[model samples]
Target chain A: MAVLERSYKRYAGALSPEWSRFLIIPRHAFRDVFRSKLFTGLYALSFMAPLVFAILIYLRHNTEALAIMKLSVVNVLPIDATFFLTFVEIQGWVGFFLALLVGPQQVARDLTNNGLPLYLCRPFSRSEYVVGKMSIVILLLSSITWVPGLILFGLQSYLEGWSWFSQNIPIASAIFLGSLVWILLLALLTQTISAWVKWRLAASAGLIGLFFIPSVFAAILNQMLATRWGNLLSLGSLIRSVWAGLFGTFVQQAGQVQRMRGGVIVETAMVEPPLWASWLILFLICALCLWLLSRKVKAYEVVK
Target chain B: MTLDAPATSSHLNDSPGVITLDNLSVTFGGRPILKSLNGDLRGRAIGLLGPNGAGKTTLIHTLLGFHQPSAGTARILGSDIRGEANQIKSLIGYMPERDSFISKMSCIHFVRFMAELSGLPPGAALERAHEALFFVGLGEARYRNVDTFSLGMKQLAKLAQAIVHGPRLIFLDEPTNGLDPPARSRMIKMIREIRDSGQANIVLSSHLLRDVEECCEEIVILKDGRLVVYCNLEEERKANKKFLMLETRGDLKSFVEGIGSLGCECAMTSDHRLKIILQDGTEIRDLYKLAAASQVQIRRLTYKRDSLEDIFLKAMENGSN
Candidate 1:
């Protein structure tokens, strides 16, 4: 019998460069995130802080509006280092919640369904898969955190003029670097937890517990050991320390941190760990998450 | 069923098979799965026939660079499996036995995603995804979510993603699994079309002999992790001595004598069933004329050739010995 002629033709076009292949994972991930109305709402809400901060910068610089409102800059909100610090801190925390919403479902579903083989069977390696999944969280967190934080910083600099911008250049740098560190930590931690825990809800809960559970244990250690070294276990304390260090406000903000926790106004005996220790601890944690991710993401699981 | 001599050559460098194994062995926790398997297969559509636990999937995985060999190595398309894994994967497509798709995606989206992962540009990937879905008979439901597809549809979607990149070699592990008769027939037809297109070489692994028999040009039968038979179906058919079965309602002794005189081997296993091996000069027409002359009624006549099942059963028997 004569063979049936197929209309299908081979693809003769050039492939995209190899480096751009990993972008496919994040591209689809962004689409999936935006597909959900709730995720879209949360993502939009994350920009609110930067938007409000931008408006505040505008109001502080516009003397006519301030005069119309009959409010002085000091009487309203003083736009200074602490103001931008608070801005970045708020944005970073919002990024954390965003990670909790989207991170657990990113790689967990793929791992649970044994879909790594599909990815690895192509031209992609295991490291590419990990970086691809990480990009989803990195892009999500970046949109709300450093990206807008820097935009607001630019707005503040534009409104306040070059003299003020030059004097406070370090503050802008702090906002960018501080928010970047926060998002990186959150992205790695959430992705690692998600990769290990197959269920989305359990992985989400595990990510939350990873941040909070250590603080409780750290508190017990602090009470027993009479040292602030235990605070190293608390992600909140470590991040705050890192943030303060980035802004060069740790010495001035330590008392406020203690007071905000409702501790007595007297001098506390617990000496906070050095800033280097905080940075070291965060780096180690990031490394550990990467190791765990590498262990879990593979084409096939060999069972002995 | 006659068994051919075992493939005793360590490696066949003279003939470059589509895939070559040189003492390839794999183990899990010191327990061997595939033990020093060596063969060269050049069939356009090769069938991997094995029972459960016969290491069919493992062999496919090894060839795809999923499993690192414990001892020797394998080369696919002149590229070593270990070092050139990404290079090899870029040129090949794989459809695993189990459910291995991202279900949350639409069929076209998933196929496009897979094609992009195989290194096609996004635009070309999208176009090829549509073409592959239509080729696999899933164009109508291309917009449907993959998770919502029926078992047969899901299988076709798997096939679509596998071929979306226009790969040079495609590995299909149980491609017709879990389908009804019509779906199975459609799958076999698709496989035949793919084979006929000359666009890619297909390695179809199946436990069902009919599926392999219908689509494969050559076969490799494995039993207990050993290569029991590696023979081309075309050669096997040509090598077969023609046999004929006759059911007559008259004296069989005279019929056997008549057939023997015609230079054919004749045997009578029962009163009414006669088996005859035809010689080169003898034909069925001559037998009918002989039967008419001998006053015998020819009720049935069947011509037989060697089948994949016969080779598989013979390979199993030889492996046990």
Candidate 2:
């Protein structure tokens, strides 16, 4: 009987990060980003918004021609650059909301059930986990910002004719690259703030403050100080100024060929204080946020 | 079903006979949870049972290399906690008490993912996942999305992920917890199968003694970060029931006077009927011949086995206060 008792017994669980731990975040984020109704809706809006603006521009341009010629229907319309700029501006604005949604949930979900402890029991350390999360945020931002932006850029170029594509490719790419930097900074800042705080809502709100509040304060300081650098210090002003700088450069050089009817486009030329400075500021912000994030990382066993 | 070849590994028998503590302790949030707990642990299945606020999770965390102990050492599986966490952890399969699986993935995918993380090759990982899920008896349901799974299914999925890697040891924090009776039994059977295998060892901790009693060969009890009861179910089961039941072919009454001298007490009901409460060192033949030398009718006799509950309570009584 004693031997039988001993024979029937068993013991078993050891969790290590060396195995399936990384799969948890990536797989969940993939499913959440690709399969959820929320992401689908957001993704559709992101892609379709550009087309909608293009269509509206086409209708506006050709409507008068169709009316004057008394044609029953119009098959073609010119692409308007104004609609494209508006799309770019709206893209930056919408990114803020996207950052708000993505940042908080990542940390808050872990905190809710003491999930950190269970996961810590695995082979991964807190740093690796944080890195994994940051990787997901970067991927999410890339999908939203660059992917759709590139498609829209291509679509617009095709509609504008091969002449415009050949002439404006360099200028268009530089401006797009600048926009990507902006998106990268926005995503990193928001995600870092999210990791630093426990509550999802509070983290989201905190990210908003981290992203915009300092810029808002800087704007007010610019008014009082009346210095270009003061305005440059504000993140919003920096983004606006940098993008405007890139656009202004495009206008001065590329517009020479496009031949703008309005007074010589001077705003693009005004974005002066060197392109490297804007990049440096963005780099600084990203580094700061990551440092703060490293501080807030709590090591414990996280489940799930 | 025994190895004629003696086990060669020093890990299996040379040590782990007694758990030795060298001023091991842990603190959390400016408060000490385990205050320099020092002791030796030797037994089969150990249950680190404690109340909710007693820092059971914290201690397990330290053991799993999650938390650095504020002071001292937690030696398990042949090395101090931190020094051999990798070696020790490679041998362990952990089942957490809650539903922590990736919610949207299919069960098979989730288990397979963990298996790969445990260093299994892709083909072997998927195969093991299927076998593990089948072992846990979740077969066809393995392909179902975990988000849609019921809580119990999710729990089982977590368990499946833990065992898919074929770890050498396992730390189950309430495996049967929150499970229905049937689900609990199914889980118990799976644990038993894993335990009986010679490939691994297990140190499962749970507050539920019933579950501990179900499959554990030994139980090491803990309370308030201190050792409370180390109930060896195998030893305890042998200690109770039919105390000193004797059979003889001669006069057992003639042996009545010699029973106490043999270091055991006796109960004489009739001339030939004898019941002896054998002491710690009493020979089986001493009683047999005592009756055989004279004349006593040989009858049926055996010592009854003790239930785990009874032994557990006694151990608990002895350990506490």
Candidate 3:
């Protein structure tokens, strides 16, 4: 009873007017995803990928001996941190996929399933629906990417050593915040696409195409036109790689920050944009997408 | 997008009705689905009749607060639907046209879940769901999976959810959509029972004219998003042409000449038969004396009264043509 009451207070105190509506959607959205055969496959793969990676590490330890295994990763040419960036990669793919799945369908469900009229007839306003949509996307992103990634990260970090995490945790905090920004951006991007499209598969393809179109244009320029401008404009890969590059170097050495630019393959860091700008664009796009999404959902007719 | 003025705000008013649409319109992708429509219905059973795409469900949505009008306002009870939707929903029982429950869930569980969604406690939701299933005549099949239910039973389960909250107003949209004739009749009878028992006000929408004519005390008909007809069973009949029909034995030519001169219509039913229909203001004494003088026996005299169905059909046809 105390456990129940204790959790209730904690949950209730975290409430905002918007949060109240969102409370069930996160849990519900997760349930929805698990119910889908395709999503369940993706979910299983997510859990399986890390397990495979963990097994590889375990096998490497057994074959090389635990002491030598630690030496190879922790000491030899290991960037001095033994920083495994697998979780970041997983978060990126999972977050993008989940956002793409839920975004358009949530919008399209109102339009296609003819639930918009019925959903509207409930105690929610049009704007409230918009809020609910965004909140659900955010929750789903966290569920599909951040939370799972963090859990795995925690497990690996604990297995690695308490000292490694205790020393590197601040950088870990920064990485977590950065992951949040990436998730928010992905969510808003999908929502913006869903605003115009009613079907999930089409909206998802459109979203993917939007990201790759930039890449295709970049590839044409980089390979065909011989310009690096193509590389800069590949926003999808840039979004994934840049955030991964930033977060993967968690708990950076203070001296390294002064001596070397982090995670750059091209040696000179002249091409990379500032992280603050990335954050601003993400938030700005979120606000803009929400405004447009509200209009789309509001314009949907529930004439049955 | 929210109106601050209480008088103008259609969402917050507390009027006594299960459902009400004052003035509501819904547009989809720049196409107007519903226009300025108003209906004031106080009967236990009120039918909303219209052709396909005539905004029956749209009006239901507006009454439910799923769609707010662009121009006019709507109110459920005294609260404006735009302002106090939660309050209105708490009292409204809505059975939407589409399938709503998760397919994997059993009928009993789905009803309980929806009841809980409406703010009922778990135990209370269960109790109410059970009672509602029983009331909707789904007692034995309540425990079966919703996927196993026939279309009629699934529809009944949806109906069960709507009433579980004990809302004052209930909206049943195409409740008998896929039902066979007998099932359809049973559904209609259930609606009548729900209303006649005075448990709640029902606004049932269907294209079935017979259902409306039999079950409803009043009907609001919509055509192309516009209200084409609103008939109070008693008032509509009263306003229609009421006249005495007389069966007379005479040559149609003589009866026609005499009745035409008297400003009456002599309808010739057969070779030797004529029906002299008396207009409201016609002097009955004159007709009797004329009949006596002509040696026409008044074989039959009866007042011709129109049924509600006739009024509904005429209104729709007039609106269309």
Candidate 4:
């Protein structure tokens, strides 16, 4: 009897648990995203607003530094609900652009080259794949938006003492909750667009347009219909209304700021839609996004 | 010669099945792609062979839980595909019939990512990724971006990814789709080694009968979403009756009748050629004696074992029936 040669070696080790598999996607995605200089540069730039806010908090506590800069005590911005709301608004846009920059590179490349089968053939479910992609944007967006916003909130809490912190505890919650809603929305919308569009640049542009074009359409609908009902079409307004509701004290201040800027009547001039309506719209948009993702994210396209 | 035995020595009846389809049917749009497939495959290396529209790819996808069966169920590695899909997927590797890879990453990174997704720790995944790349003869090009690989290299990289996780079963769809003859031989040799090693049960789907015959132990033939033939290739070869091709000079009809009278099936294939299917007791020595006594010269004589092509043709005939 002759023996056969064996060239393949058997694996004797144990496998990792199934739950740990979902992290694999985001781990590789993070590496891919950070490999780009443009993404790294923009990611670093996104922190500029938060750093300014942090310094503003530092300066607000230092009356001596204000005097050195020849700025009056009255000129110093107070660390209040409106202040954090404005901070969130700025960081929200930063998160938006960051998501636009980062999100397309995540899913669009996977779909274009038919990499989903390689992924789906593994232990990953469709929802897990979506969550894995979503987690990358959420991590990136959170770093720029809520993570720093809460740090600034904590810094202000430390500087202003317990009395101010207790009286303004809602602002801290608002900062966290508001940034989460914003980033989650951005992440979902961007992933949705990236899932549908195969080209990375087109997906990125689609994300930007998902935000900007709606506002333009809302303005057009508002002008033609002569009703604030079209304000519902503006994602910015809907999200801001949710933010205003979260902050509680910023509704009046938001209206005043809009009056000061006096740009589009549909954007700031319109009062936040009924609070429930804003929440409902956000929920609907998120549901629509999830629906789009479930449709497009698949290993094989069913011809029927 | 020992290849006549079942490929795997394990007690297949006692061991868990590699795949079990219970009336598994899949329909796309309105037409059914896989119509009520039912079988239990226990072979260490199973070949899925079929013509166009034979539902080979659909069956692979349904086994991977990429497609939901219209009516029945499929259990892989003894796990139900409907509910235990992820678990089933964790146990098997799939090399789809297309170019599926993230083009931006190096070959190692891509394979490592696949291993990690298949439930290996990152460190172990990286180590195994390198080992797999080397195993598939892609060690030098492991650092090269996947898009830069040649067609053959890409196929090898796909194989590397499929085996990186040490899966219990691996479904390789058209593993040697586009390759030169040498590359195809290399791939077939690697596949034979994998099958011989018994590291993983392989389900190879291909239109090329030679590729299947080279590596697979058991064969399944399908036509029009239905099972045509499923049997061990060794048994099929053994059960086939012995046949001979002969070139005889002078009096071919009388020679054929002389063999026919001895309970053999004989026919003239051409003016000078005779096709003879010998019965159990008949032997080539008897034919030599008969030709000598009949004054017919046996110019050329060759014994022929049934090939996979013969089996495939028989299956196609059966499928038509």
Per DockQ, the best of the predicted structures is 4
2 versus 4: better TM-score goes to? 4
lDDT of candidate 3 over B254-305, digit per residue (tens)? 5467667888777776665555666667676777777776667767776667
lDDT of each: 0.85, 0.63, 0.64, 0.83
Per-residue alpha-carbon lDDT of candidate 3 for residues A235-257, written as tens digits (9 for 90 to 100):
66455445645655422121211
* Lowest-sum lDDT 10-residue window in model 3 chain A: A6-15
List iRMS (one decimal) for every candidate: 4.8, 8.6, 10.6, 5.5
Q: Using lDDT as the measure, what is the rank order of every candidate, best first?
A: 1, 4, 3, 2
DockQ of each: 0.36, 0.13, 0.09, 0.40
Can you write out model 1's per-residue Cα lDDT over A1-304, one digit (the tens) per residue? 1012234445667988898888899998888888889889998888888888887888888889889999887766778888888988898888888899989888888887678889988889988888888888888888888788778878888887899889988988898889889888988888899889989999999988988999999999977765678889999989999999988888622331233235555445557899999999999999999999988887788898
What's the alpha carbon RMSD for model 4?
Answer: 6.1
Give the worst 10-residue stretch by lDDT in candidate 1 chain B.
B1-10
Candidate 2 vs candidate 4, lDDT winner: 4
User: What is the TM-score of each predicted model, taking all chains together?
Assistant: 0.88, 0.67, 0.67, 0.86
Off by over 4 Å in 1: A1-9, A76-78, A163-168, A252-268, B1-16, B241-304
Highest TM-score: which candidate?
Answer: 1
What tens-digit string does per-residue lDDT give for candidate 4 at B192-311? Answer: 888888888999999999999989988888888987778788666654546788998987767777898999988787888988888988878999999988889999987667688888
